[model samples]
Target: MKSHLPEKIYLASPVWLQNVLVSTYGAFEHRRRYSGPHKKYVEYLRKNVFLNKTEIADLQSKLLERTLKHAAQTVPAYQALNLGPTPKLTDFPLLERESIAMNAEAFLSSKYKKEKLITLFTGGSSASPLKIYISEEARQKSYSFWQLFYDRMDFHVGDRKATLVGRKIQEPDSNNPPFWRYNLKDRQLLFSSYHLSEKNVAAYLKKLNSFQPKIIEGYPLSIYRLADQIIQNSIKLSFTPTGVSTSSENFTQKQREIIEEAFGCKVFDQYGSAESVVFASECEHGNMHIEPEYGVLEVLTNEGKIESEGSGELIATSLLNEAMPLIRYRIGDLGEITESNCPCGRASKILTELYGKVGAVIINEGRQAPTAAIAIAFEYLEGIKNAQIIQNEPGKVTVRLVKRTNFDSKSEEFMIWELKKMLGQSLKISIDYVTEIPPEHNGKYCMVVQNYYKFTVPD
Candidate 1:
């Protein structure tokens, strides 16, 4: 295991500082025997989080006899290694993040405590920031999902993934090369989500045109925006991307449609967490599937059952990443089950409709989608580099534009009429002119946020 002292959890610098995150975990040791009450807790967790009734029953029978035996032989926190004359497993106790943050050194396994281990930190947007402590074995096993999932999609790690994000805003200069790639188990090219301007996009496009990656991943809206530019420039998206993926935020159908036109590829939406846990992933058939191999999905319903589709809470219990197991963890996202199965041969569960990420559903009024008439009208506008329309409330909308100063009132009138012809007369438009738009709460910029969407956490 690696030390947090040399990590970048504490600063904005190239290095990770230890203080930014601290979470104590149940400690383990190699070449050790457990003799205390470890069996009881492990059995309870296995039954509640990992097994079904039959499996639990079968496990219980074995556990009935070996609970003491297993604990005495394996778990370190136990009191007696083999019920020895005097054991102190009770002294260690159940581990947690708080304790780890207090004493990181004592928890490390003696075998590899001095070895070099790759490290990482959590984004902390879901609940609270956590300092993740892992071993080379832990890191590889914990992060093996994407690699396997992609291989399932027939794409290899050496291929490039198109990333559309809205994090850092970088103004162009030859000093820092606009493109960067890293060896994160697989190859990657880091592009700036901050510089998607008309000129910047054209330049970004030219660069991508040369790199010619085989896949795309990142923000949905940014990819959609790039698609708008591609259409305007008469750019051919015939480049065969193995697949297009999106995450870190909610994806609107409108944005997905745009990405399809721009990338000329199917979009795969993946849902995950810093817990290094897998939630759900989209299949080739445009259907989202859960990797139950990694965790169990529990949909908590309300009293109504009236709004029926099993919509309420999405709670999950991870299956594989056991370095630190989270039991019945609340994801805080609202969703429902879809009875339909994908034409693809994937054997996984499905969800019907998903309202954006975590508490985003809100009541509001605003322009919805462009009618076939508006899409037709877009053909007439000139100097129109790219655009995004967000309905804030019942009668208000925000328009993000990247165009030349030559856009006069006459042009505005034409654009307004086209919008009116499409969204109908009930909605009003609010144009916010800025060099570029910034990402929302997370590092992702969702194209649409229900004008007044509000989410409440239960007390």
Candidate 2:
């Protein structure tokens, strides 16, 4: 079996040497992700963001045409369709994860050799892990989109930042301080999400106070857990970040509220995928605007027809990533497009609702209930740090919760009452209290889990 030598070496080394090794790797990544055409792409994105809706549509159409032409010419998967020049976007079939995973190489561009392309493994938060390949230029350009969005929040390249994502910087068993490591290249302090707990949270807080990062970015669950610690302890930090950015997880409104209250800043949520298919970011007005230059995001109904508004599946077609173009990829997300214009004035498309994935929906009496709607049960209720609803049998759910000191039986009863109002009173509910709720292997929290999948029959 193939082994990760660097990971083995890092684990064997002392903590100080491990920090050195992490910084070394960080330096290498910094040069790779921000080098070459990254700056040029950032400049283009900055200018592209201000275009009117018509101009944005024209640019997307042109880019989409170019991508489709390249895919039809070079990619084995798309070439099979013989998509003629000037083929409409709808001409391509909907791409699913299974199709890509079963034959990933067929999707690669014949123009590039597999050995030269950069390979990436997704963390498998919403679905099974998938291996994706991209050209070096594609990788760097993908980073450029994020760099441009971060610039809007006054977080520039080389700015001091703190990240609380999936990276296991510290040993899981180590019960000590310094649950983080620094990367001098990007001036980033990488916090280990695995090590976050009530016992070690004070250390995390102290380090955040001392580091004084200009921005904090990470999975929403990790950041929310930290924010919960701060609020529960009533701790005040010495510094306030310019902004707090969250990605890689389904961020809820309650999580955003707690994070903003704890950090004393706005919580900006960015929507993108390792697939590089779609990109969206929250603006100052709190609207999530899709970056039309990055990709075309189309919301489709259950019948597979496109919808301008209302919640439906998100179909994404990449304008970038020429090395392995994915057209009309159903990325397993459910979203709602908005008709109301964002006051921020960016002419790109708007997403008013972005539920994590179709799997997040809970079912009762043959009807699917969005997790967002179920989550409203906890709204305005005190003394609940975290709650997760698990469904195994039809009309039955087990709610696991971590409670604050103020929690009482009344709070539990109120939550149950509120939940039944939406899920139907016939739904059976049970509560399980725990010291804490653990995150998924990828460090993302899933608030809703359905163990049985035969809820909705075929149409």
Candidate 3:
């Protein structure tokens, strides 16, 4: 969010020039992520996966000690705690998002200057974005985990990949054909989630056939919409990926089924946060395994007691990021960690179930829509600060929005039009422009709140 091109400049550039800019940015990212320590880190993870339970625990303890020592010595926020020469993870109090946002500078290490670190802004979940900083080494280490996961799925970095995530390659309101851009350096084709309507999907499919990417990675709902269309029309894809990978949103079994059926391959769903504190990837055996090498994950109950094998909120400590080290940070997501071991021969912990932002389903009469679909409705819309969708009854919905000073009738009209294209014409949609959309009781934002069940029972 912090490093994106200005809207005026992006719109003013010609299509070819836009591709050039995208490729150039992609090349920079490729060099930053894949150089130096990346390969070594990936190799370490490859062998670390097979480590036994006791071995992993020992590795995590050492990593935790190192991270805590670095933070207590260098970070001003942790220094105030007076954590002694040897302190446990719980010695530091649980960190809240407000604590980070209010004193962001205080959290930074004294050794690193703000201008020197790579600053990243988280998107899609909160009304206010949280800025996180890290060194290039930490950034590359974080990316290595993802590359290792992709390797498990038979896809590697620099391979031809078609990404259906939220990238503003094209205008939100445009109805034209090319709703995607090519990053030649990374061998990636970035597609805009805004223009994935029925009218434009054929063109998208045509392009996919020609590009023939080996792997497709994106939000599950965005990919699901394409798979749903393929199934509905009984259309066969001209190409098949080695496998499909999904992240950035909660994935459902139904969505996985449709995607796999359409693509004729397995669907691997991975869970991670932009905060870089925790990561979990699905194995070929279809189990979600939490890599102990990345960080220490603790599932805790409402009373702050750790849950050994059941459902609770996830608390994690990052072993990677020292620039702004977060120890025992409340990740604001819920999940069930089971004691059951994965048959895939990995000793990493298994997450039996995980939920982020609830992934609530909005029902319009008989048709159901995921929250990710609703969020994509506002993609590339410049004037919108935040938006939320609420469905109280079937076939009726209300959208609450926080708009910027430049928000106009055109922005609202395009949003409504996009919503209609996805939900249906029968969906009675209403827009309410407000100052802010507050977070829920758990301090996390829900993109879609479904009260349809409270209003009436299903058929």
Between candidates 1 and 2, the one scoring higher on TM-score is 2
**If scored against the real structure, what TM-score would every candidate get?**
0.53, 0.78, 0.84
Q: Would you list the C-alpha lDDT of every candidate in the order shown?
A: 0.47, 0.76, 0.77
For candidate 2, lDDT tens digit of each residue in 38-85? 999899888877788889878888888888889988999988998787
Expressed as tens digits, the lDDT of each residue in 1-459 for candidate 3 is 122336448767989988898999899999998887999999888878789988988998899999898899899999999998877787888887657755678889998988989877553454333568888888899889998889876888878999986546665545686878889998999987656667777888889999999989887777887888788899878899988998777756777888898898999888887678888989999998988877778878867697545777888888888899888787777788875677888887898887675556566544445555565566545466677888887778988888876668877777776676555567788888888888777655787888774321112
RMSD after CA superposition, every candidate: 16.8, 12.8, 5.3
lDDT of 2 at 153: 81
Ordered from best to worst lDDT, the candidate numbers read: 3, 2, 1
Q: Is candidate 2 or candidate 3 better by lDDT?
A: 3
Give the Cα error of residue 241 in candidate 3, in Å.
1.0
The runs of at least 3 residues in candidate 3 whose Cα sits more than 4 Å from the true structure, single-residue gaps closed, are 1-5, 360-444, 450-459
Q: Could you give the candidate ranking by TM-score, starting with the highest?
A: 3, 2, 1
Top candidate (TM-score)? 3
